[model samples]
Target: MTPCGDTEGDENCIAAIEALFKAYGSLRYGEEVTQLEHALQCGFLAQESGAAPALILAAVLHDIGHMLHPDAAAAVAADQNDAHERLGAQALSKWFGRSVSEPVRLHVQAKRWLCLRHQDYWEQLSPQSKRTLELQGGAMTAPEADEFERLPYSREALQLRRWDDLAKRADHPTPSLSHYLGLARGLLQS
Candidate 1:
């Protein structure tokens, strides 16, 4: 059964999501943009690219694990890998299906995969990303890349990663968090 199968569960899920953003959305993990801004920008990019609702949702919530981390700023400051991808996906799985959660689970893998698959991808990474890449296992090995490619939602994860790489611009305008939550509510209904 879905996590938010009941009306009360859905309300609780929505409230939890709202509370999450409200509580930690201002935190940044070595990025110029705040967590909320990065999320909104990524969601906006997905919308602009005409991604499906699930993908758009995935984009918006992919980095939520960062906010969820107990001390993400400290983790980043220490150059540690928080494994936010897995954490975010696990949290989201309660309210969303694989289409939304799996991409989040594998977005970091997608970054590693892209570094191996595309020569220029590594060069495109910001210094912070490059530092985190080492913490995240750097570029994928051949076997790892193959495994990542075989995973379901791998392509979507790659798309999400690309948007993630571009979402750190400060002062970028985006739709309010409520707008994306509206999408989330609609997704729950359908």
Candidate 2:
């Protein structure tokens, strides 16, 4: 069901992901690092923590919707919500399992959940993240929090969110895109 269909190691899927990065990965959307940098750092953090392959892949691709939708930044600037997490999840579902896609979908909600659960968490958000927080429905209410907690993969989404926050370091070193893509290729092949 991937964009390139279900063929093991589909070249079109791999090429699509590669093309996305080649085009947009170099751009920084009000962040210290480029999109690819953020992705690599996130994947590194997840891998270093010994997360499962699906979780690592989810972390690596959490922001790909931004690449897929070029107008997301302009939309945010115009006070519109593009719901990149939802977009990214939907795109990824074509190529990945629910274990990967669900966390990508819930990562935005995970941000809202963290803000509600940890009082200091709000202070840690980047300026752009702060803006998106409002656009993402602000902090979660008690009922919303309780509801979110019951969702499958919500916990992994929270972990992915944590890595998302930390992955913005300007000078973090990580493996090449092909290295991570090779890891992903294994999953795609399966």
Candidate 3:
């Protein structure tokens, strides 16, 4: 994988990201859809909802840490928490600002927060999500929920989490990765 850094140019960053997706985006972590499918669906949902550019990009790339991990599918099969949220946010920080990375960082916490805040949220999750939730520490405690709520991008994270949950439909058509890559390039240029 190409290591993206602060010194890299925009094309390099985009190439690195595109390469990562191309390489590992086919792996499924107990989900019906591939990683790329989920990403495109989530990004399409965000765009349909009229989300801002940063948010749209965040929705698209939220699960990028799965690709970044050395063996994310194996980790999932082993019933381990890969902490993809942190990894994705850290990797994305090299090119994207907090508007994108923070939401990606907080998305897992948002899942935990949703479980705490909504009575039926847990029931709505897919089996894969439920498995990951257990691996991800189940739900947040009351204090943890309060702390998470206070974070700057917490609300955006929650929104992204919703899209994440819904993006797993098999054969659901959405825009290509290039579309979101275009958005990312625009964000970088701006």
Candidate 4:
């Protein structure tokens, strides 16, 4: 069971991720809001933060779960259903392992925890994100958040959240797929 499995092995996960982005980035929400644009922004943020390649890949494809399942992103926030984590993890599993999946799962939990832990965090969320957080119970009870904070992964989750926050700049410059292609080959080996 190789990462690329039977899908024209040359494509690899990096190529697969890019294909997904290229295929979907053009679909508009309101005026011209495309998932493609948002993914590049997220990737740029991860790259700027010194997130390792796997994490940068996680950042790039975190929302592909939503693209594969559109209603999930539109009608439901990851918090309410936590589908983003589960879906992303499942999608990347074919080509990625713990290094990427761990952070992907934590990213959603981190979002919920952030909302509960920091009022400012909630304030900083984008309008669409804020609305989704409400649907996901952004205001988790103190006890619940405390329990989440107690998880061994809480720190990693928080770090992922910080990077997630940092990764939202629409104009951030991300390297082209060719740059990440080399990085991905080296990372899968590591």
Q: Best-fitting candidate, measured by lDDT?
A: 1
Deviation (Å) of 34 in candidate 1: 0.3
Is candidate 1 or 2 superior in lDDT? 1
Candidate 3 per-residue C-alpha lDDT over 64-154 given as tens digits, one digit per residue, 9 for 90 to 100: 8887888866764564688989999988877788999999999999999999999899999987788889988999999999999899999
User: Mind giving the per-residue lDDT tens digits that candidate 4 earns over 1-190?
Assistant: 2356444653566676666656665654222345655565666677877877777776666666765565644433333444667777777666766776677766777888888778788888776667666666667688888888777546655776676565555444667656655665555522
Best TM-score goes to which candidate?
1
lDDT of 2 by residue, 60-124 (tens): 99988887776854653453568788889988888878998999999999999999999999998
lDDT of 1 at 1: 22
Candidate 2: Cα lDDT at 2: 41
Query: Could you give the candidate ranking by lDDT, starting with the highest?
Result: 1, 3, 2, 4
Residue 176's lDDT in candidate 3:
92
Residue 113 displacement in candidate 2 (angstroms): 0.4
TM-scores for all candidates: the values are: 0.93, 0.92, 0.92, 0.75
Candidate 1 is scored at a TM of 0.93
lDDT of 1 at 99: 93
lDDT of 1 by residue, 1-190 (tens): 2358888888777888888889878877455887799899999999999999999999999988876788876764575688889889988888888999999999999999999999999998999989889988889999999999999999999999999999988899999999999898877632
Better of 1 and 3 by TM-score: 1
